[model samples]
Target chain A: MRASIVQTSVAVVATLLLFYPVLQIVLLSLNKLPYFRLGGEFIPTLESFQWVLQQPEFWRGLLNSLVVSLTTVGILLALSLPGAYAFSRYKFKGKDALLSFYVVFTQVSGGLGIAGLIALFAIVSALGLRNNLFALALIYAAGAIPYHTWLLKTYIDTIPKSAEEAALIDGAGVNTLMLRVVLPLMAPALAVSSILSFIGAWGELILANLFLSGENRTLILWIYSLMSNVYSVQWNRFAAAALLYSIPPVVLYVVLQRFLKRGLAFVY
Target chain B: MRPQWLILPGLLLFLFFNIWPIIYSIYISFTNANIKNFPPPPPWAPEELKQARPPPDFVGFANYASILTGPASSGFLGAVFWTLIFVALSVPAKVALGTFVGLLMSSDRVVGKPIMRALLIVPWALPLIISVVAWRYVFDPTYGVVNQLLYAVGISKPPDWFVNKDYAYAAMVVIEAWLAYPFIMTVVMGALANVPRAAYEAAYIDGAGRWAVFTRITLPLIKRPLIYASVMTAAASLQFFLVAFLWNFIQLYDRFMLAYGYYWAFGSPFREYGLAAAVLTMSALLISVFMILAIRLAGLMRGMYES
Candidate 1:
């Protein structure tokens, strides 16, 4: 009984630790006292929230986030769907090597390529494309290719090829068969990839910070820039903005938790 | 059956954007590329930064030589050391904690397990940018929750969390683990649900204790998923920046990891394109060498994951 109590206490503590940061942010958003005033009395108000709503940056960031994320997902799916389909069904030379390339390439961690790309984008920005969300989306799509391709290819492999071959023998063209028959069967995989890709693009900051400027900032950049000058940061307003900024990603993850589990299982 | 030529567009983009950058990084290592005297004239202005910034003068191996004998060499070494330590510490901690939480949630013994599990994934579900930023604030010196709670107790002077190098580094590790362990936990819980109940019943019948049953029966069954989680987490921790950099700016130079080094090398106002490319080229070379060795050692090339 004592051991069980100890275990329960430990579990409860761990769970509380997970929720603490979120709680603080929520409280900070609604509180009258600035900086959350840890021991101060709670006086809930919507003033901070109103302040966030009044700022054009919040709406701009929202619009930019949606555009960037959607364009990224669109471009990613366009590339990954076909690339994965071929890798799955085709008997090409160096197919295994190619698959290995994607797998290994994905493991190369942060910003090695981004370093080079920054210089490229600097020049591109000089050519009057600074703060362009499409250009940002294009960079995001290119970066997402290696892993998304691998994921989609693995997913495509699970699907039996008999249906595809049957469709082929019925004199259906390749594109038609892909679009009509195999596509519907691969809905779960497509859904999983799209959600994950959207989440990635939505939260991306490093590139957006460097590539974008002025009013073209994403939600993350806004939060970061607010925090950049730490001394003058209006804590209540920042917290309100932070909480509002987190809505889409939180919603996406919650609504599609099932797909994420299914999708991530294959990633391992 | 003929899904051919469909890969062309992706391949081209990958080549143009991704592969080209990597190759360009290597090529620029041999040239003079810095933004000190940039956009020289009409030909240079509005031209590709690579051609205009870099003098188009081939300075063979000079960039590499400078780094080897540079003031930043020690900083480079320190970054490498800390990167290894960060990876070494965080990966195992994430795996172990994730497994423990997974076991707790999966077991029928724990009450209110549903709420516990939901709360556990809150960090993972939220935007990482916000979560990381929140963690940074929580570790703040005076007005932060952590210090406030510390003062509310007995200790009046709670050491500034992000000031000391050791404290800041430890906080970064903890925050990152908090952010990431959910991935492993969720996966393990799912994997655990698939574990055959019959195996446990048989183990219990054989007079195996709880520990024996877990270590012997449960562990081996879930080993593959655990290994995958470990490798993924390990790779992530190696390049961890968002948490480590956000926690404190002052101590960053003392422990600048490879990712930050790369960021500073080229991303700064007066970009050192040639030297930055050299850094990236060397970093890539080292990584590929390590990866090839890891693959060969594990025999991962020939369908180790096929089953």
Candidate 2:
């Protein structure tokens, strides 16, 4: 009983320590004087949130973020669905090598540093796609595929081969087996990947800033530029924007909470 | 039907978007491909592929040699060293803290395990830049809550976290560990469940000490998860940019790390693509070396669970 009490206290302490800073941001958004008054000034106001709402760019950025994030999720599912099935089902010779390559591939998560990306952006533009959300989504999806393919493959592995064999024996073609037979079984993993891919594209700053500009700015790029702006950077506005910017991801987390627990239970 | 065909779309995407970019990035490192040299037009402005200018002159290893021995040499070295230090500090600390928390969660005594698990994901799930920006405010010197709290505790004359090197380093690492530890904790928690309760009971029946049981049985069982967490965290830390980018905005350039070094090359009015690419190429090489060493040391590749 004493040990249990101690463990419970530890859990509470960990949660408090983790959430306190986030709490401060939420509070700072409510309070007007973030800089002038450091002590607990609980005077709540929505001026900053209102101010962010007034800015046309914030909404535009949100829309662009949604577009890019959804695009990335679409592309990732399109590619990883088939790729994962092949890895999980096929009896290929070089399967282990390919999987190993994908494992090492996750480490290159930086996705060509912003500087290198700038150079590549030049080429991408030359190919007649510049500051395009779809173009940026392509890059985002490409970056996500290697790790996610490996991830979804592990999920696919958990489903017994008997189902696939049974489907094949029913005279279903490979495409039908993948689409009709296997995809239904992958619903939970697909949700997990969708949430992850969406979250990644939404939060990504370096590539968004490096690739998209002007009208195509993602929410993070807008938030970053707002903070970096020298003339006028209100802490209240910064706090408000950051909090609002985090909503899609937090909502996704809450909505897909169940899938993530099972999907992430074991990652290979 | 050829099984290989299913992989072709994924392969083409990887080749075109992933492999081609790296190859071209390396090629650009050899040449002077800065915007000043080959400026792109405004986004709204349309430009045809036929109108795009020819590539710049290849300067061979000049960029690499310059970054190694130029006026920017020491700054680059500082960044690399700090990157290594940040990784070295943050990864191990996170794993340790994560193991403790995971073990805590694994205990039957811990109540509301599901709620704790869900709450822990907040740090990881919240957008990273938001978290960094929030921390930036938290570390503010004058009206910052951190300073206020420190002074209230009678530690007057608290260090300005952003300006002070040691404080900034500590602050950055702590924030990273805070964000990262939960991930390791989750992975460890999952791994812990895999360790059969019977195994522990067996050890207990044998009258083994707590430390002996953990060291001999628990450690071996969770080795794969530990290695996975270590490699992922190390690689992420080595390419650490977002926090550094925001933190260094107010701080000096020397305190910056490798990723920012790459950014600085391009951030300046006179864009230096070759030099920036040199820094990038080096950063990628550094991260790859770290990942390879980690895999070699921990045998992480052996942990890949497949059908």
Predicted complex 2: CAPRI docking category: medium
- For residue A153, model 2's alpha carbon misses the true position, in angstroms, by 2.1
For candidate 2, report its TM-score: 0.89
DockQ of candidate 1, scored on C-alphas against the true complex (2 decimals): 0.49
Q: Which stretches of candidate 2 lie over 4 Å from their true place?
A: A1-3, A32-39, A45-50, A111-115, A230-233, B39-54, B153-156, B195-220, B250-257
State residue B163's C-alpha deviation in candidate 1, in Å. 3.7
Q: Clashing residue pairs, candidate 1?
A: none
Model 2, B1-307: lDDT tens per residue? 6667787788788767776767777777788777655544545554563246444678998888877888768878888887778888998888888888887788767888777777777888798888887787777786667888898999979998977877887898888888898888877777777677778888888999889987898787677777877877887877777676777654534554555455655556767777777777777777777778877887767654520
lDDT of 2 by residue, A57-146 (tens): 999998999999999999988998788878878878788888788878876657344435755666676677768899889888887788
Scored by lDDT, the top model is: 2
| Candidate 1 residue-wise lDDT, A1-268, digit = tens | 1136666777888778767887888888898877775676778999999999999998999999899999999999999899999998888877788778877777763645544553455445545566899988988898788788888888888899899889889988878888998889889888878888898899887778767887788888888888776677688788899889988888887767777566446643
Give interface RMSD for all predictions.
Answer: 3.5, 3.4
Which candidate number would show the highest DockQ if scored against the true structure? Answer: 2
Candidate 2: clashing pairs of residues: none
